[model samples]
Target: MKTLGIDIGSSSIKVAVFDAANGSCLASTQMPTDEMIINSPQKGWAEQDPNTWWSYFVDAAKQLSALVNMEDIKAIGITYQMHGLVAVDGNGSVVRPSIIWCDSRAVSFGNRALEKIGVEKCLQHHLNSPGNFTASKIAWVKENEPELFSRIRKIMLPGDYIAYKLSGDITTTAQGLSEGILWDFKEERVSEFILNHYGLNKEILARQVPCFGHQLELNSEAAIILGMKEGTPITYRSGDQPNNAFSLNVLTPGEIAATAGTSGVVYGVSSSIAYDPQSRVNTFMHVNHTTKDPHLGVMLCINGTGILNSWLRRNATKGLSYIQMNELASQVPAGSQGLTILPFGNGAERVLGNRDLGAHMQNINFNIHSTAHMLRAAQEGIAFSMQYGVEIMKTVGVIPTVIRAGIANLFQSDLFTQTVADITGATIELYNTNGAIGAARGAALGAGYYSKSSEAFSTLKVEKVVEPSRNPLLQEAYGNWCHCLNQQLK
Candidate 1:
């Protein structure tokens, strides 16, 4: 049997076909050859049309159908960019453009909620301050776009919205809700306290479902649209980070997963409930979490990571390939020769307490610094930013001695991977699998093709392992980078 996996990402929609019996990806493709447009009507605001996602999804499915037998695809699973707010009317039409993960427009509203709801109460129940999450985004709509809010019959994360499009069922999972700050960790359900505080009707929320299991079936209309058989069950759904961890088989306590794509993330699974006091690093239900076995994932996200590198490539390097950029960066020694880069330009960073400090490059000397030096500094800065968040994660008991990541994005860079390993003091394992493949294997597990999660990933193999080197210069460079970062924060 084959399984279909769809990853609804911020930049593009990805689809993959996996051989369920062998856990090998048969085919994969992405829609819109170029990155999808993220509309920003105003600074600090990001929006995307849900209809655009559906259109691209259909395009992606059509491409996938040419490479695989759609009829043989047994199950569908979805993983999406987390913390996005999608609202739909009773007829399932989008009420407004989705407020995506990187949008910082709702920061003030979230801060107000944090103050009004009381810090202790929020920390205990929600495990995070209402800081620029989906809940806050919804509240923004209600306060600013009151008419649209009144018509909203359902609120969903991006993955939930895609699943609804596929199955015509409005449902979400605990893991999805937690990413939105809607799930109450203490109560193990949607938080009525948060709903009441935001004046949001609980009815607006989608029906709750388990992360795994047959949640919905592909409807005939969607089947016809995608040239797939009707009634194929959508067996699994999760936010991208947790699904990335699941894809790597980092399911147990202390096992960690890292990803550096449009954004950077460090996700660690834990058996106990833990919260960061500052609410910098957030915790949510892992894909395999249950009331009895409660597994939580402590996550640290840096909004600016590969996007910074992409920015440099576009504005500075004049269209160099990422491989070229990596090769150029590798030429520079540690610290980028006293050049420092602070990659906080993308949006409000949670690790910086939802502050939009903007990207900064300091200590540049016209005579001494070269383009290669700038490229290396950018990579080192991104690594240091990750290490900064990892420190907060350690405070919450999710320490990582070894980190697993896919051989994609920044992990493809030897310099980038080495910097992360050396700075964070952890062994980095690179895998051949990506998010779509993970979602496919998760579909197999949820559909009962595999009786256990282990069976689903039994074929998973590590491609390479990177260990930290005892480079004395790395520590000194990190210290200088931290000093610059602290100065900016102050």
Candidate 2:
């Protein structure tokens, strides 16, 4: 009567149970009384204990059981942060702390591997640079900690680790492999070129499994711990982004999904096999991706939006709250009176050719521009950056007609949302859903409760809709912003 989905994230473990008949969330909650700590033993490194993730999962299962009938759960699914490296020995015990998605320790390894593989060859086959992804992290281990590397019987992504814990099986989907930069899209298999380059063998990698099939059945040990029936099949698994897309029904080509958090991402799904020469957006396998029917999630990330806004709040906003800031800025007419603030102050942006054009506050007139103008310009700049990235996505055939996003993060800002919608000329639909809900829907579809993928989104609630008003001011601001960006690049 219900399908369960667990989102294993860096921040927390979110679990949701979905009603099979109506596709509505029956129960959902995130565990861990506090945010899980990301240990940085050294700067630019992020790691977490895999055992801690399992503990949170156990706690979440216990919490969910108290809220709903655990016996009604017919199938299971998992979604998690992408590009993490979890290694285990033959005994299936974790050998090291997980090198999470945000870890930069493997950057040099990834860059060196790319040079060895040749840029064009890597883009052509790997569909990505080996940069800071799972394989590169593994390569770092192999070279930097050879003794530790030798003991790693197998390596898997974050979600795969959770699945392994539940089912006592080590397997992954092609989608998972692709996110880890371990898949050869051209060859449609594990990248032997990378393995050979990194001096690793296929034996250490998890076996490939179907993304929407019976990946594995729950083992007695995990079942008893979680108060669930043993042998329950886990039918779906994916990285958080792809699963978030699926949750919003952005499955087929031309459908789009966007998330604006510390980093802003616009994921557009398309059937065409394409790659950006500048690597503005990374391509990953969508949940429904197949060799026969290619579903590519062309992801465009603008590394600044929320972080820039937060910085402004802490330092520049003086005493105004975010709501007050939004209200005040809403009064300022478009273009912020010719003042432009480039939101790229966060760090190097991929969309801008991986350049760190250190957040320029340009064309400033201290007399003319007030705090309101700065706020408006900052929001517009962030929106323009998204518009800029989406333009790059278009170069690879990912033009968004409708952008879907959760009713969270910067999308919560009417000024920000309207700016993005108007500039891109796309209808923005805000959904009251998250990654766990999407994985739950995926679970039902995989369990054959829904005949088609679209049916799974029947109860997906749309909180609001922002249709483009053809706002010429936003267009003018974007043009002005782009000109300034071009000058900065030169």
Candidate 3:
């Protein structure tokens, strides 16, 4: 028998079936064939219909059923984009469009909340600022859309909403609550102080469930619609980043998981109870976190990463493919011949004190520069940006002794991976796995298919390894990039 893993992401819905015994993906499919649109009702606001995610999931499930026998699926797992706010009414109907992770509409509310709640208290109790997280998004709705807020019977993260649809139960995990800055790290429960501060009632939040194990079972209606077996347990659920780390087997302290997708993220696991005072890097409970054996995942996010590369491809590379751009980048020497680019144009960066310095290209040296210089500088800038956050992450004890990433997205580029390794001074390992695959492995552990969590990773393989280089020019390039970034901030 195989276990099913469903990944709900902003771009698409992916479904996979895995053989738990050997941890092999039996079949997998991604739905809609096209990128889903993020509705921006206003500038800096991103929203998506909750029901649309369900619809796409149903479509993906139908496709998955075509590849494997529905009866062979023993359990279900779910992972989704983090920190999204989904509110449902008493009848479990969506009250409004979900305020997604990229939405910046709640910045002011989150800032005010941080000031009023005090940084020390928030950091001590929640291990993060309530900064544009799900809780702040809910607060924004409560103030601006009172009618809709009144109808909200329960609010949950994106993964919790999917679990609700699958099992007819509304529940969340402490890890989920921590992502929303609603978890009390000290008390080991939801933070009632935050709820009271936001004038929100604790009753509106979903009840807590363990991140793994038999949290719920497939409801008959959902089972019939998706051709899944009724009473099949929903065993595992997590946000995408933590799930990615688990997928990579980066469960111990000093191990880090990095991803360069539409945005960039570095999630490092540490056993120590820690928090970044400036909120430069957010901290959330890891998938395996427990009171007896605590694991905190410190996350560093760059709003711009692959998007900057995509922008370079569209505007600067003269219609070159990503592979071609990487080739051009490789031709250029380190430091891009004194040219530096800061890849922070996507939006306000939390790491940069929520400042939108925009994308900066410095020391262009127009007389000698070519497309190669620009491409190489952009990639190097992203790597330097990650190193910048890594410096701050070190403050909270999330040392990136070894960084693991999937052999996809930016890691697919040799130039980018090498630059990241050289800049961060850490060994980098790339694996041929992803969030959905990790969920499948997690389901195996949660459903007792595997005797221990480590068994699920027995088949996980390393595709490549990158080591830090002792290149003076590479070090000089990062120094130049930092100087330019400091100038922009000033």
Clashing residue pairs in candidate 3 (N, C-alpha, C atoms within 3 angstroms) = none
Error of 3 at 441 (Å): 0.8
TM-score of 2: 0.88
Q: Regarding lDDT, does 2 or 3 come out ahead? A: 3
Worst 10 residues of 1 by lDDT: 469-478
- Residues 1-490, candidate 3: write the lDDT tens digits: 5898988887778788899877788888877675677788887778889888999989988888888897789988899989999999999999999998878888889889999989888888988888888899999999999999999999999889999999999999989988998899999888999999999999999998888898999999999998978999989999988998898998888889999876789999989888888788888999999999998899999978887887788788788988998998899998899999999876668898777677989998869899999999988999999999999998888878689999878999999999999898999999988788888888888898887777778888898999998889999988888899999989
User: Regarding lDDT, does 1 or 2 come out ahead?
Assistant: 1
**lDDT measured at residue 457 in model 1 versus the true structure, 0 to 100:** 79
Deviation in angstroms for 150 in model 2? 2.3
* Residue 361 error, candidate 1, Å: 0.6
> What's the C-alpha lDDT at position 162 in model 1?
94
Cα lDDT of model 2 by residue, 1-490, tens digit: 6999999987789899988787678888887764577787975677999999999988888899999988778999899988889999889989899998767677778778888889999999977777778998999999988898889999999999999999999999899889988899989899999999999998999998899978899999998998889999999999988887888888879899998765688998989878886576889899888899899999887767776777788788886777888898898998898999888764456677656677889899978998889999998998898888888888999888999998766788898899989999999999988888888878888878888876777777789999988877778888999999999999
What candidate 2 gets wrong by more than 4 Å, as runs, is 32-43, 305-348, 355-378, 470-473, 476-490
Top model number, lDDT: 1
Q: Write the per-residue lDDT of candidate 1 for residues 1-490, one digit (tens) a residue.
A: 8999999988889889999987789999988786788888998888999889889989988898888888899999999999999999999999999999999999998899999999998999888998999999999999999999889999999999999999899999988888898988888788998899999889989998879999999999999998888999999999999999999999999999999998999999999878997889998889988889988899999999888988899899989999999999999999888999999988899999999999999999999999999999999999999999999999889888999999989999999999999999999999998889899889999999999987787899999999988877878888988898889889
Cα-based lDDT for every prediction:
0.92, 0.86, 0.88
lDDT of 3: 0.88
Which of candidates 1 and 3 reaches a greater TM-score?
A: 1
